[model samples]
Target: MLPAGLHWIERWLPGFTQRAQDLGAVLSGTATSITAFDGRLQAATHDDRHVLLMASRPFLEARIRERVTALPNVRVVRARAAGLVVREDEVRGVRHADGVVEADFVVDAMGRSSRLAEWLGDAGLEKPRLERLRNPINYATALFERPTPAADLDVAAAIAVYAQGLGATGLSVASLNAIEDDQWLVLVMGYGQERPGRTLAEFRAACSELPGVFAQAASGAPTRDIATYHQGESRRRDFTGLRHFPARLVGVGDSVASFNPAYGQGMSSAALQASCLSAYLTSGPDLSVPAEGFFDLQQVVVDAAWSVSTGGDTERLEAAAGIEPPEEVRRQRQVLRQLLEAGLVDPFVARALNDISYMLRHPAAMADPALLERAAAATSATPH
Candidate 1:
């Protein structure tokens, strides 16, 4: 079961499913690669037992935009940015190609290509510090129709396969409504070590190279057009770590930190950050501590998401150097691996894993010795 509070994933998934159905579309495909800790290829394909949980990227983005724009206080703008304007160590506003937009407070929500820092530098404000993720990843995806028999099957229970070094990761997911119209969603993700092909024939060939489940799914589908998105590396700016920041401005969403899209934490992180900002803003004006409080809250969300993404990145042998997760994190991940492995076999465990994976529960809660002991007991009791 999903968590009680509404999450971006839940909200976006339904909107995407509805949009696809409206357009006579079915499932969307996503194949994400991973670097296993054991230094081996771990690729997954579309025909796997678990293809129902993934949705199309375009639909997902559209749904999120729809929800964000509906907020009374939120306004959406479509224009390229020119730069930021500041004076006397305080933020004045932002300048875009269309015109200058000034407000009592200004927020930079731009993604990885944020020009806020450069603008800060130009305005003589302190430059923000940057930390990049250890891995570089890319993605390609398409939609497909599921086989009649697979329709209505559980797609959320699907598992992904990660190939360590063979041109990114190969995996497939079946969206919530993909089976309603007999379709599925598939994505191929490229990791630091592996890069997947982009063209249709090449993508099919790459999927064929994966495990039987993925290959069968790719080979079985009557596919839609293909698309690609390049979002490499996870980046975080140390705004909280800075001693001085402009009082009249704040940065949120990808402007503050961006995770590898493969980790699927970007949207969730942004939601949490926005929630923090809302709370800070609702508390009324406090020029004395608004910026610091905002960053501190954002760091909590970023650190939680980064811990998981970076942990996985470090496992990839060809990952960028200079990032070595602490031993404690490594050990904790071992326990998580066991849970995931168990989840692959037990439906109950899968639900538990899903709950934690979606950030419905604290990561530390999963580490309870009782849960580990229960998992061990359950594993031993099962037939070989």
Candidate 2:
């Protein structure tokens, strides 16, 4: 998880950070840095101001479940959600095989394939417009056992190698992370027809094309077979702009928006949305009305994540399809390219870019006039 998500978790569940560390979550020190390579030169961005926590999804989810079930007001129900129980333009409860479990409010956390829209249509409510970015991204992940006496490892906690300018290379992106249990989690991603194969040899061959750290990490004994997944698109359901919606019903996580998992923004985005819900509830809004205020707050979080994840994909996909984007879109892409070029050599620009990438700051932070001016100057001054 990113620092932003961890911050909210620590706030809501006191002592979560310490507990997670104790339970084998690898928390990077403040000195941790993320190294990025763009097929040619490399740059390292220091996370001196924030630390990221690297833990497997199961490990993190188990910890969350342990804490949440301990709450007196919450209960663990082992049942499938069949549908929503709506009455008088409000979500009154959930329908399951056994019966309906009523609630004053309902949160749809059923993930990317959430049936909330279908249920809403059944309830005579308008469905939110779904926006999709068709970028066929395929990725594979493999786990490796870390070498004994961990000090022998040469790589940092995180490394990202991009295939931006590499000509005709099947690979698009590759990364490695130092996780708990003295293991390394390596992932290789490709776009469209470039699929990362699901074999140890193929995984290592792909890593060999990447930087040295990836090769070194892949040399370790394989702990598991490579697992692969394909995402056809990044999607978001526009609930904020909806004119007709049910009251006391809200969506979070992938139910609201699902981005390219490569960006690692899903969990962090959901946590921020949960924080929005908390803020909305504390404000004592009338439950009889639609949760427009909550949606407004959630939209900001979604838009930031969506922009960060989709900006580059949109540009690349459009170019590959032989389609030119609008003038404004082209200009925005040019500005971002300048900022990235400047970030390679300018610490200030690097920090600002890293902050937005990690969701520590909003995407709007990139528009700071002073930052733009500095980036432009740095881009001009730096030797190509």
Best by TM-score: 2
User: What residue runs in model 2 are displaced by over 4 Å at the alpha carbon?
Assistant: 40-47, 148-154, 161-169
What's model 1's overall lDDT?
Answer: 0.59
Off by over 4 Å in 1: 1-55, 63-78, 145-157, 163-183, 205-217, 220-225, 228-232, 318-330, 345-349, 379-384
Candidate lDDT values, in order: 0.59, 0.83
What tens digits encode model 1's per-residue C-alpha lDDT throughout 126-245?
Answer: 778998865666577765666754334433223344535333234321112243345555567766435565777777786665544445556655566777776556788888766566
lDDT of 2 at 187: 89
lDDT of 2 by residue, 189-230 (tens): 888888875788888887887767778889999888888999
Every model's Cα RMSD, please? Answer: 6.1, 1.9
Model 2: worst 10 consecutive residues (lDDT sum) = 148-157
How far in Å is the alpha carbon of 143 misplaced in model 2?
A: 0.1
